[model samples]
Target: MSDTKSAVGYTRLSQTSDASIPDQKREIRNLADREGFALLNIYDDGQRSSGFDAERPEYLEMQAELETGEVDVLVVRDRDRLSRDKRERSMFYYDLDEWDVELWTTTDGRVEFTDDESWLIEMIRNYMDDVTKRREIQKAKKKVQERVDNGYWQGRPPFGFRLDSDKRYLEPDPGKFDTALTVLQMRENGATWSEIEDETGVSAGTISRILDNEERYLSHVE
Candidate 1:
């Protein structure tokens, strides 16, 4: 084991992360055992988004270890576990290259810095991850809009409103609706935004927006 490569595994699960972490770890372990790599440790970022600016504590720790030359190879369940953004994946790839650490994945296979085709394949894998995430996001947004059109709230209910018992539509809050209506009436009576804010305790910006979107708010009032 001492003469073999000191390898560390990294796994991340964002969307399907709950059921996939164990599976990822098992695959990495099996690979290490079969390939005779000296498995040093496994790092995981559970439920952490693979976004460009996400705070991945375990991933950062792994990078620090890589910098210190503790690991000769890095293993992951997939390239998306490292990053879904091309810029971030490229940055991580170069950093690992600088540290002379190889990358092994269950999905895209092993990548050594000296292997030119390996780098191209890794890039293609990361690019595909980004494309998949974008498509998922677009589909989610379309579904949300469809729900909104059907009079269902896509997210949390606004102030002075609550989600109905079925958790689909926004319903007027018995305690807060009167105040909201009074605020709206004041705005209708030529009250300034600041005046509405002072009377209703809602922010001036919010009050202005509520007044501006007449069809959305007034429809509820009627």
Candidate 2:
């Protein structure tokens, strides 16, 4: 972020989360100001996911621009803002070399990045990113189980019955719920799994799962 450096801020937001985008931009802007960097452009990919499997539109666009030698630095909120994948993380390492653009990141209120000893810095960054992503996944899985154990619906809310509600509780849809009940009844009535699946238009696997769900069967009885 030296005065000699010119930068562009690259930001991405998940498709459903624009609520915090303003704060993200503000954080980047403040950093640019404090660091005395002449910001070249603000490249924003709204409603885009930056996970490893997907390449964000604005991110790709910025890459094209960088390849043309447009930016000297790329700034973001954190390592995860770019990616959570170790392989995708390597893209940054190489891309910076190709474009001669330094990656600048601020996490926990401090600006960090590579320097003369950049490879060493990148190695540590790569390690920390992997650790962070692993812990995040584990935490998400545990939260799902915790919600299920607390008698709340677990995992992402399925279609129907207020899917967007913040609360974890399930409100069984009348149509699907009835189908669910019949599937369970058929199972207990000694119907073949495939027979129940055909009757309910539910996937055979889904039918088997609903039939096996102790909570759903108890509620079906109630």
Candidate 3:
């Protein structure tokens, strides 16, 4: 059997301008080769946010591999590629310890968890990343709310309404307004969600939103 250690790479991209997945992969592969590790696979979470709550399919898959205890090393371009949330990163570090997997990064080289000083440095880094992510989220929400305050629609219009000529406000769609009205009437007449869905082809979820925000939909038609 070959003496080379087995390694697997992971990459994640949250934005278009961030380091490309290909670039991260190349960096991980180069690092693995230079360190005499035999790279077994490279997992990617394309366009997936590093938020703690975000459901990353590839990240989960990589974790499952780690649980098998066959992977000797986990490679990434940087620690942030693993997670931006400090709490989440700490939990992951614990799991890596349990699985006996070494984490190698192109920027930081091998991560050493052997000392309090090293742990402090990692804690500081994770804290900074979490702050930056939260600020970006706040900025994005502010921009979206500003647009809504300016009488502009923030996202896709509801089922029965379309954006007006300028695409700034919601207007009743002539083709679907009657259907919307029918759905509301049916629900008010004690029609079940499944019955309405069967009659109008509008999903129960969409029908719920339409009923919940009935005033907003009615405002356009009135």
Candidate 4:
């Protein structure tokens, strides 16, 4: 085992990010200095989630180098920065162990492969991270369902509707309601989507959807 080795840092900022990539990199750099490792390169996965996505471009590139025994040290701000999934994290650890590469972290310092406590701590953290992601996703789905039940559009409004003044609910566009109705009536009278589009100047896709008024319209309203 070498006393000093070439190191590369990996960092991630999620899609719903708070611009923490710089802070993560700074911590990794500090760790490199404290450990006397040569900080050779840094990789970032910006606006990407470690929980949902299996592939991150820069992270994979780093893994390729790690596989070839090029990076003697792999540093991260935290273990979850590598992956929220325990399986992926284990795969990375396996590769590092196979290559005799050392793992370093700003939070945990240098890892000792024989330390069972360190391994358990990592497993717990990864489990917690995954749980948090699942909870967040469930919460978001519930919120969207609530909005839909309350007659508020959860996402962008259709062509014949616009957001209310508060932007919390979709209201029928007074200017476009008649056009939507016309499309529906024409379709009912055996008009093709393109024919309806040509007649009403609305796109064929929107016209097709408008024909399914229940999907794109609020009940008890035009």
Candidate 5:
């Protein structure tokens, strides 16, 4: 119980850290020792920008340790002390929640699963995490809806159309688009989905597949 390798402490900053490693290190080591954690490692990134997505090697390394069960808990001053970006911070919290790793923040000291007050804390955490996820989903849905209204290609184009050099618009491929028109007219003529596929020399499956794609009808001229 007097050992010092049981948990890892991760500290970060979005811009530049006004805090120092020696300072944060002192606090974490003291906290862990007080709680009887062995104090595995203290991961720090002094001047790293959080703007670089997935570029924090130290953070990723800490996550790897968590995955391999190398630590009993992860301590931070607060979630923002981990990362200001919501997605990245949520990523760590989500993985910890799944792995059942004790997440502690001195801002709200000593969060633990066995604590009597944990249930209420956990309920609030769940609600907060849910709100974060819902906001992300709603943002994605809005982007897609906007794209559809503008007739911009939000997804890959059908076999006949290819994405433009900029990957923005879908441009008609002469062979594929003409063939598509043939298949479309055939469908309009009461030809079966399979028949149109066979007659057009485009696979019956491919023909049928294109018809089922929402972009075929929904993607518009922007």
Candidate 6:
């Protein structure tokens, strides 16, 4: 058997706007080659949000493989690529400790788990990553809110509305106006949200919003 250590690379791009996965993979592969590690495979979570509650199939697969003792080391472009959440990072570190697996990163080199100093450094890194991610999220939300306040619709248009010529303000969808009117009529006639949903094919929550914003819908009518 070869003396080379077996390793698997993990790459994650938290958002579509984030850096490309290929770049991360290339860096990890280069590190592995330079370190004389036999890169067994690469697990990529492309364009998947790394929110605490988000599910990452590729990360889970990598964890499963780690449990099998086949992978001696886990490679990532950086610690944040593994996780930015402190709780998640702690849990992953515990697993690595339990499995006797080493973690190597291109940015920080090999993560030394044997010393308190190393652990403290890793904790500080995780905290910094968390702060940076939270700030970015706040900035994004503020921008979205500002757009909405400026009468620019974000994401998809509502059921009975479509983007206007400039693709900013929402205008009533001509084809769906009748359906919207019918929904309003049904609600005013004492129809339950569920009943209206079944009859009109619009969701109950959306029906509620439509009814709540009834004046806006009616304003478009001649």
- C-alpha TM-scores of all predictions: 0.65, 0.59, 0.68, 0.67, 0.46, 0.70
Model 6, runs deviating above 4 Å? 156-167, 170-222
Model with the higher TM-score, candidate 3 or 6: 6
Top TM-score hit: 6
The TM-score of predicted model 4 comes to: 0.67
Which regions of candidate 2 deviate over 4 angstroms?
1-5, 13-19, 47-50, 107-117, 145-151, 155-169, 172-222
Candidate 2 lDDT over residue span 2-100, tens digit each: 447788887777545433567677878888888877888877776556455447777777788888886777778776676667777776668778677
lDDT of 3: 0.88
lDDT of each: 0.80, 0.69, 0.88, 0.79, 0.70, 0.87
- For each candidate, C-alpha RMSD in Å? 6.3, 7.8, 4.3, 5.2, 11.9, 4.9
Task: Put down candidate 3 lDDT per residue, 1-222, tens digits, no spaces.
Answer: 877889999998887867998999999999998999999999988775655654688889999999999989999998888988889888898899889999999988999988899888888888999988899989999999998899899799888888998989888888688888989999999999999999999988889888998888777665
Which sections of candidate 5 miss by over 4 Å? 1-5, 112-222
Runs in model 3 lying further than 4 Å from the true structure: 156-222
In model 1, residue pairs whose N, Cα or C atoms come closer than 3 Å (at least 3 residues apart or on different chains), thus clashing, are none
For model 6, name the residue pairs that clash: none
Please provide, for model 1 over 29-86, each residue's C-alpha lDDT reduced to its tens digit, 9 standing for 90 to 100: 9889978898989998766555554468888888999999878889887767788788
**All candidates in order of lDDT, best leading:** 3, 6, 1, 4, 5, 2
Candidate 3: residue pairs that collide: none
**Model 2 CA lDDT for position 42:** 77
Q: Pick the candidate with the highest lDDT.
A: 3
lDDT of 1 at 128: 80
Pairs of residues clashing in candidate 4: none
Q: Lowest-scoring 10 consecutive residues by lDDT in candidate 1?
A: 46-55
